[model samples]
Target: MARTEFPAKATHAQTRAHNASLVLRALYDLGPISRAAIARLTGLTRTSVGELVAELEQDGLAQEVGRGPSTGGKAPTLVSLIDDARHMVTLDLGERTFTAALLNLRGEIQRRATRNLDGADGDAAVALVHDLIDELLAGPHSPILGIGVGTPGIVDSEGTIRWAVNLSWTDLPLGKRLAAHYNLPTVVANDSRAAAFATFLFEGEDRPTNLIAIKVGHGIGAGLVLDGQLFDGDGFGAGEIGHIVIEPDGAPCHCGRFGCLETVASVPAILRRAFFQAAESGVRIPQSIEAIAAAAAAGDELALGVVRAAGRALGMAVASLTGALDVRRIVVLGSATVLGEPWFEAIRDEARRRTLATLARDTEVVNGGPADDAVLLGTCALLLTRELGLTVRR
Candidate 1:
């Protein structure tokens, strides 16, 4: 006999909840929207939209802001998001440091703090994050809605960090632990992906849809936002391009790989090369990327060589991505890109030379600078989306 398939429980109820979330998000994005306008935008029945809006208003996620002009009869009262209804805490966990912030409903940071962590041990990291949140909440603020964390690695669907070589984390239940500590809705996402979302929140209006955001720092990673949505693969590690092998046996990487892009294109990689060259030539090597950039700006051949070599590696990686993803715009963020236009020009020239004519013609490369607040901002967005139920479809 054939195996019997069980029907999904309360499909209609889940659908309604999802649709209600859509309605709320629509109002949040396009504020002061009329019920009729929401119905027209979301394609839900007028009655369904009305019911959802009433429910949202009752929940204090939304409110009637003002009246809208009517074409025929009585003007309708406009509805918008209650920007001060609640708050969220966002944690930006990087390989070297962590930044925490409290964001309000309008996605504005109310309070922020930064600290450097020794390593990415799950327990120690959690303790540090909890203490930071406690300190931030001690200030004058409203009730918190939830917490969001952005880390570097492959985050599973259940929020388990599969692997973060930079942080030395593996199979860590970060999301569960944070939620348990705060007893609030929590979310964990890839740092690059979060950065992509933050970029969209900050500059989506000016950028194109088929865009590639390359984050070059201690580690080299890319975040692809296609069709205005963060794209993650089945393993939730779509943009783990840092580990992509540029040379089969180049330099050793933390991921136990050789010649990965990060091993050659990251800030540390450039510093290592500089130090090696300086040692061989009996010259003092610059200590940091900033110092190196300063030296290069002063016509230091050694500094220029370091920057140019890393730029070539980065350009090759970008060229590969441009060919594969066929993205038109590439936004590079981190210390290396800020090393001045020479480094960027090297990468851009190589990419244009190697990429197809059509791809090169369409591509526009620009430096995004160091995303000092991107991670925190993205974490805030994650919490806001959960608490207020805002999403792209809505």
Candidate 2:
């Protein structure tokens, strides 16, 4: 028997929508540009561009900026996107707090609000999210376009949080719940994946579409963007690297494992080691990542040694990524990045030592230095693409 197949087709509306998005993209990337320039760039008919521009103007998304210099004829009027035509609400659910913000179309923060979770679990934590959103919405803003959420743990593409140990959530339909209660478009994604997308979108132009962003806070995970698209893997665990065992005989992890990357490379790991070292040296234990960073900055040999060890652990993961994926761009984010230059040097050194000479030579391991709002902006990016068919440009 022959294999069954179905023919694919696009309806007239679908074609028009796709073309409209193309026109918008051209205007966003190259405007203040003339209609003729947009037509030339997008390969759409001049008539079609005119109609689309008029529609966009009527919808308050695009407007004429000014006239361009004459090209041996009459000067052309330029049009540009109304960067604030729409607003999106974004949230980042962190270990100790939940932060929310109002953002413009360009992913610029308009206003922000936060609430401390304080180890709140179950219903209380969920309510805290609602409280933050309500507070932001109650501010001087109306007609919100949608909502975006960045959280920890496994998140299905359908926006279900399969499991978040810290948040006390399991198989929670957070996306659906938010959308229904607020009656707005909602998107949810893992924090690392969202950070990866944010790095890919905002890292400037003429760059490769593939990049990896590793979030090393209390946990360590990575997000991969391949060919300008987020690859969630078959099980939605594409970037779940924190739990991978690096030292099988080392200390036990909370996930019931021994010597996982999270046990050595994460912020908690560094702090734990710092405390132990302090106990041995009869020195006061540093209480936070910031304090340890400050100590390292003051040339504390003990603190620097602990940071170097953690950085080396992280570099092992980088070597794995470079050797396997050969992705040249690796961005490290979260509070752990505050360990500063010494930590970064150790990471780069180990990654180069472990990977192929040529691959390591071309790889650029960038420290993003605690992009606190990356999750919010990344979910906003995801929302703009999935809901509005638009790419965010700064």
Candidate 3:
């Protein structure tokens, strides 16, 4: 009788993929390096490095650049990554608008497109997404690697939008739908988490091992990068500090929660307070964040008070986050950052007052600075990490 043969998992194929990613990462990060250097860095055999490099070269993803200085031996040939070898279509599904961009391997935007929601929801919003992607793909560009979508919602690991109040999306299989339609890889992530990864990855080579980037805009949320990896928590809602209750009897949040942090700290919350306070005081109503910020800068008492209250609410959230996680580097970004020093000072002071002295003293909460396109760039970062293994850790 013939011996029974149990099928084995393709361990060799998995190993090859892992090694290929390693090689690609090396070329992307430390290009103009020799195969020997890559082998040394990646701990692979020289033969394996040569074979992988050949594969990369054949794919037009890398090429021999020049020769490097000899080190007591023959001069070594250097290879470099072809940055534009493959393009990525990334989307930022914001509260009021959807932005898409064509990006290269280096996360640089080559082209961009936008679609205003105009109160579109359900299938209409999805159609807008499709239209934007179609328009982007119908142009001159390199071979596409994949699509990445940074959407505002509680997205699961499978890229299903669990819920998005603004877009009125729920239980949508967006990732699978996109991949099936486009016949390419696709990744969908929470916009806040994506922005946090962008901040961490774009920190150049000196990024912290752990960081928490809170996005305070039309909505309030946070993304936590712990130990050089994005932490999605058990329910994929790790950094959802927005829905956390701050005031038991405060305003209602879109999430159906009363007195949630989002009700007090988000841009809309701040604007609502500013409007009511200004109305009560018979002052001119500020209709935009820019105007409100200007008033705060000019020491308008009403604007300053609203900024302080909003910042303090956010500060309470920060204190809870830092006290629980002990992460020292906090980056506050998004539209609310325009409120400037008064808002930031209030946040810092409140955080310091609320947290333990030792922890508070070491923590640094700073602005992320003009991150209007953070969501778009963040999607690019996600695609690079997932498709090419060019992780943010260096």
Q: Which stretches of candidate 1 lie over 4 Å from their true place?
A: 1-12, 39-51, 66-76, 119-122, 279-284, 383-394
The TM-score between candidate 3 and the true structure equals 0.95
Residue 234 displacement in candidate 3 (angstroms): 1.5
Of models 1 and 3, which has the larger lDDT? 3
Clash number by candidate, in order: 0, 0, 0
In candidate 3, the residue pairs with backbone N, CA or C atoms under 3 Å apart (3 or more residues apart, or in different chains) clash, namely: none
Ranking by lDDT: 3, 2, 1
lDDT of each: 0.81, 0.90, 0.90
- lDDT digits (tens) for residues 1-394 of candidate 1: 9997656767778889889888978887898899999999999999999999999888787889789998899998899887777888888887778888888777777888777887655667767778888888788877788888888888976678988766667898988887887788888888888877777667745656667788888887778788977788777878788988988979888788899999888999999999999899999868988998999889899988888888888888888888988887788887676688879888888888888888888787888889777777776776666666664211
Model 1 worst lDDT run, 10 consecutive residues: 385-394
RMSD of 2: 2.5
> Can you write out model 3's per-residue Cα lDDT over 26-121, one digit (the tens) per residue?
998788899999999999999999999999999999999989999989999999999999999999888888999998888788999999999999
User: What are the runs in model 2 whose C-alpha is more than 4 Å off?
Assistant: 1-10
lDDT (10s digit) by residue, model 2, range 76-190: 9999988888889999998888999999888999999999888898889889989989988888874678999998989998889998877889899999999999999999999
Q: What is the lDDT of residue 333 in candidate 1?
A: 88
Top candidate (lDDT):
3
> What is the RMSD, in Å, between candidate 1 and the native fold over all Cα?
3.2
